[model samples]
Target: MISFSALGCTQINGAEQNAATPIATAQPDLAISGNSTPNTDSPNTDSPNTANANTASPSADPELSTAIFAGGCFWCMEQPFDQLPGVVSTTSGYTGGTVENPTYAEVSGGSTGHVEAMEVRYDPQQVSYEKLLTTFWHNIDPLDNRGQFCDQGSQYRSAIFYDTAEQQALAEASKNEIAEQLDQPIATDILPAARFYDAEDYHQDYYQTHAVRYKVYRFGCGRDQRLSDLWGAEAPSH
Candidate 1:
């Protein structure tokens, strides 16, 4: 069994928290010059205003790029990225493990070496990777080498799974900047991209699907308070 005292919160894997009381970025617009076919790599560059006014031809822009982040519970990570302007979708999942198609039970068992993570599909033009990193750094407790917030265990450790050398450099640069800004040293890891296994269906869109439960868990766990304490004025509005 995991110890909650070490982290100062209840230790439950990805399980929903019990019901309780509730609680509660600048980016440039990219312009699309031509009618380009959308793909994962070639996302439409048009700004939101000119892109799509109707539901039928939404975005009229290119598909967005993706960034995977492992920061404590996937549920906590999803909402922040989802709220960002350029982020198209944030899918909670597992990564950095040797096992393939590992189930939640297996991962929670703590032997699979996988950390709960979120794959963020975002439009790079609308929101630069640097901005995303800034948003991410603010959301997580980078000083917690063991795990994030109230969660404790290797499975809950923080990490950035970079897909390219450029990404790696950007992540490292961001971490260094954070270190300079704060007195405490940051512990978030920077690693290469690993095979990301989509979590169980129930785990998908957790905040929206289980808004009440998520709010209680976040409040009781002290995620926002801790983040505000760490980031101060730099903290993003949640």
Candidate 2:
């Protein structure tokens, strides 16, 4: 197991120390208007652009492909893929929402139309899309439509945003497989790829930075145990 320190904590600096800081419980007031981007002074931290520049450089492997997913709180969703062998990077962010360049504050408000999502850049040659979809299913509660686990509202909805027709077909097939495997009908939505806005820097790698609190949140929310019950032998451990 990789220690938290070894996984990189620079992404979140002062967050852990202020773990007790009360995160705003009130949802922000946001109105989803068409496909228009939201007006905000939030910094632009495009993950794909950065990944294309950093990992897609001449020296890096060229077989990798990118996939975007929204499965509730991105903090929890990011964990499984981050541990996967062939995944190059997993960036936590927002997608499928109407508000453009939304902040954590805005998205949490339940009005931004954005679901907390992760942008996964991986080597498809190494890890198949089917495997990634399998990992995604194990990490989230597909039975819940009112958001995932403890988190409620649209921001936490489960969605698989496909980047291509092949991805779309695979996503649908995977969902069907799950539906047959489980007694409950799968509730995950298959949506087309939308403009994925990378979250603010502070929201990235939140679990690694706030390890203790994240553990508490995960445990208190019963996310892992629920997944274990659902996925049985396939569930990944913390």
Candidate 3:
């Protein structure tokens, strides 16, 4: 069982409410390794939902496409995609559940069936979905069935919510590849896209708004250490 101080984000943060004043940096601490080479490995045809219809904050630009992935805490999930070039915006949210507009508290309870997820709007012309998949795989522990890092519960389970058939195919291929590469069964789910509700305003960019607390909680939760242990050199910095 997870400890009181490490009961995912809420309880853990409550313990250190007075830690330090959060300082918002003008820029993210680290950037994703620029891999501009478009992934020809997967089919790139436009599907019905390929446009910005299914996700929150739909981009007016038709060129921008959205991809949703649940990789533990939405806080850690945003930074990786935010650092990438083609990504327009990353919204922390809850999805893959029956509830509508589920709150952080509800999801954190582990009964909403909604996992904390990130919705990434990016330009496919600049960064391919396959590249995003690569970054996602390297950042998460695909073999973990319970949850991610120190967070235990369905709310923190890793998942890929694909919006289109092409994405579904690519996701399946990538999952298979990763399973083979690791020689282990991956527990991350690849489900069809569901209604994604934007998390509370504060949760949008918790890492940025609560930098000090985010860092302290993240380290204390052993997120980075586990990533390094599981991913080795492939582990993402920041």
Q: What does the lDDT come to for candidate 1?
A: 0.69
- Can you give the lDDT of residue 79 in candidate 3? 88
Mind giving the per-residue lDDT tens digits that candidate 2 earns over 20-55? 232222122321112222223333333222332111
| Winning candidate number (TM-score) | 3
Q: List the residue pairs that clash in candidate 2.
A: 27-109, 28-109, 38-100, 97-113
Better of 1 and 2 by TM-score: 2
As for candidate 3, its clashing pairs are none
- Candidates 1 and 3 compared: the better one by lDDT is 3
Candidate 1 residues lying further than 4 Å off, grouped into runs, are 1-63
Model 3 — which ten-residue stretch has the worst lDDT? 43-52
By lDDT, highest first, what's the ranking? 3, 2, 1
**Clashes per prediction?**
4, 4, 0
lDDT of 2 at 202: 53
Q: Once all C-alphas are superposed, what RMSD does model 1 give against the true structure? A: 13.7
Best by lDDT: 3
The digit string of per-residue lDDT tens for model 1 on 24-136 reads 11011312122122222322212122211111111335566778888898878888888889898787778888776666656666788989888888898788889889878
Q: All candidates' lDDT scores?
A: 0.69, 0.69, 0.74
TM-score of each: 0.74, 0.75, 0.79
